[model samples]
Target: MLGKILRIIGIILMGLASALMILGGIGTVCIAWFPENWESLAMMAPYKLIFQTAVIFTILAGILGFWATIKLARRKPNGWNMAVIALLLSLATAGTKMYFSNMARGSVAPTNMRFYFSLFVLLYFLALRIPAIWDKIRFEGDQPDEGVGGLAGGAAAIVAGGLTLTVHLWAGPSHTVNGINYVAYLQTELLAAGVGLIIVGLIPLALDLWKTAVSRHTSETLKIPVIDNRA
Candidate 1:
């Protein structure tokens, strides 16, 4: 019962995060492109990159968290992994944004929305780590082979990282004043995450391959007939 409740809460938090991200993204875009008086909003331009980065980070992590929790409810092993990653990403991105917001604005009050969201994040991570909760969602039945999937995922991540890096390069150097290229730095961080994803995806494949090789070698060794010819 507790697990179920936790799952429901997690799903709700992720959905709320997604909605917040969408709204934030829309606002950011409008602020970036639609301001009629550029001079009036010139002060806002410097922080545009931060908003954009937040938009991407929030949207991606929120959506991923939503899907991952759903998968967890359905008892898929990969779901836990994805959920963990999503939460971590959310921590890094949303958490950072929240921290800055707290600094720029005022410290979040215990009754504030940020406080609730932070609580939700903490609770969700804790729920996910509970072995009892995991056992409740444990997938039964024949497991699908992950070798192909891992390889595919790895390849996709590598290709995506390469493409993202290329686009960042082609887009030209990020706007810089006073030695800060916030957008560029965020993009580079994203590129690094992509590379990390590639590595993550590859690990399962490597393990699978190693296991297959070892099994084959053992089977071959076992197949060797004991030469009773010495008799």
Candidate 2:
């Protein structure tokens, strides 16, 4: 009964996460892409490229999250793995946002609340891995869990970050296109470099996090029928 309750709560949290990602991504893209007036224009002019790139990642995460949620609802085999992915992406973004925002403000007292909230939810998600919960959620099928086999995301991040930094160097600090706020580091081409590095760093960290979370209670230790959740 407790497992069932936790499962229900997890689904609700998952759905909320998906909706927030989609809505927030779209809103940010609209504002940054179409700056309505001078204030909005000035706000996004410097870091528009970063905003655009993150927006792409955000939308993808949201879509995958929704797909995974549907799969879970239907007890599909791939749902477990997909949910892990969606949660990882969401964690990456939340951490990056919190880091950059704190850096910009030069204070950590009042951080982006999403960071803490996402982390708590992530831990809660991990706690739901009890065998009883898994017995309820896991369907009989192939568990295509290749958590360590793939470096594609990390390699892609490296290339993107390297290219961004290269562009930043080539741009030569001349007005950040010499059009808008060309001088500020946080608001100029430098921001792209920062965001790019964050992406590069976070991918592996998220992967490691996933590995650690799923490895906590193996069949050997739990003494039950193992439903491999490492994906």
- Predicted structure with the largest lDDT when compared to the true one: 2
Model 1 pairs in collision:
none
Q: Model 1, range 32-89, lDDT digits (tens) per residue?
A: 4433334433545545667567657656765786566445434456765676676566
Candidate 1: list runs displaced more than 4 Å. Answer: 31-42, 98-119, 137-231
Clashes of each: 0, 1
lDDT per residue for candidate 2 within 1-231, as digits (tens), equals 454455545655655566456544553454346544444245445555666776677778878976765555445667656767877776676565445434543432211333455566567677667676766544223444233212323433344345344433433232233355323433445456546655854676588678777787564487767698998
* TM-score versus the correct structure, for each prediction: 0.44, 0.51
lDDT of each: 0.50, 0.53
